[model samples]
Target: MQDEPRPDELIKAVADFLRDQIAPQISGHAAFKLRVGINALDLVTRQLALSADSDAEELASLKTLLGKDGTLVDLNSDLAERIASGVVDLSTPGVKDHLWRTTLAKLAVDQPNYASYRREMQGSESKEAASS
Candidate 1:
């Protein structure tokens, strides 16, 4: 497989592309357009980190917010990459609606293969799942 593009390069390219090619063509004349432009750049930077590494520790740490099984539910790497590439509209007002909360709940009991440690968790109970 080929090496993935660095997230920083992707972010910079996105910013440059938007600034030089897209921003000029935007119809808005308001100062907020510039603010929106800056926000897009910042958002792109923030998104890039999501694909840098697996967020296992972050998921583990979020057990409280996520509930017992939520941490074990694996993140969709494709979703992470898309988010990093700005292909997913996470900045949209209703973006949270797309979260996989229900899947987490189901995984807490079924421990689907989509779980972070599916092979390890097989034939295990919730207590064993935690250690996995």
Candidate 2:
């Protein structure tokens, strides 16, 4: 196993340094570019922290939905083909929930700050609460 200060932590540290130390010293376009770079770093950090579990869950869902096994990319392609052929779609059990979950996972990594994503997350939390 690796030592302390893992990749995500290191990335967060770098992003924090850039935002706290470098960002204030910059101005205009440079500041904008720095902000973009910091955002990219933050996204990478989130992916590193979250992708494994999300990907595993997605893979499991896809395998169950497709009734077969393959790499995530291959399974997704197969699913797409099935959807295109009208053999599997929202009418299929698990398809709708799987798609919604996958979309939410992606949005969590890619656009967590987006208003729609936030709303969807809130709705999901409400549903979970109601079900409990």
Candidate 3:
């Protein structure tokens, strides 16, 4: 909608300034708090950069798996209800893969550096490479 510096870019610039400039000038509790703030900004930037596509993918997957259409929230609730009622489970085709993809997408935004997430991503890449 706007010009060159998009929301994610602006957030990253602010985070970079905080990490590179302000952080070194602070100490103790304030420094820790500044680091937290920078981390939050970085997470927000990742969400802005990644969530749209991930959400769309998730919605499509949900629609296909559940064989119905609705807003994402409503579809997710429907799926949850079905799963709780034993109508859907891991044995259901696509459920396991859908869950894996959705979790990976969330982790990419929330905890890209998490050890388990890294391992899972590596595993996925290996599987893709092997398939190719």
Candidate 4:
């Protein structure tokens, strides 16, 4: 595989440039669009940085929670069906934890700065320690 800067770094750099340099030079509708573009780039950077581990952990959680293996999409579909049919619910062991972890992982990539996400994360370390 290739090295240096990497895709995430490259995206972050462009986003930084847009936010710090370009945004200030524009106004009105163009400025609004530029901010949107920067936000999109930032999101791509977060996804590139976080999705690999997030997906792997999510896959593991699904396998253990469902007692089977499949593509993430397929496993998630099965989980959804089971949930809809009342075959699986929060009362199931690991179901709530798996859903919580999955939601946290997604929020980390989608909007890490969100206030509730920050509050949830502040308690995460203690919760992990307690569980351990």
Each prediction's number of clashing residue pairs: 0, 0, 0, 0
Candidate 2 lDDT for residue 29: 98
TM-scores for candidates 1 onward, in order: 0.31, 0.94, 0.94, 0.93
Candidate 2 per-residue lDDT over residues 1-132, each given as its tens digit:
899989999999999999999999999999999999999999999999999999999999999998999999999999999999999989999999999999999998999999999998899899999999
| Model 1 lDDT tens row, 1-132 | 447677656776777777777767666565368657755665556545542232454454334332344434344444455577887664644334434443343343333345474643564467777898
Model 1: lowest-lDDT 10 consecutive positions: 64-73
- The deviation in Å at residue 124 for candidate 3 is 2.1
The TM-score measured for candidate 3 stands at 0.94
Q: Pairs clashing in candidate 1?
A: none
Q: Which residue ranges in model 2 land beyond 4 Å of their true spot?
A: none
Which candidate model has the greater lDDT, 3 or 4? 3
Give the per-residue lDDT of model 3 (tens digit) for 1-60. 799999999999999999999999999999999999999999999999999999999999
Score candidate 2 by TM-score against the native. Answer: 0.94
CA deviation > 4 Å runs, candidate 1: 1-4, 16-31, 50-55, 64-67, 71-132
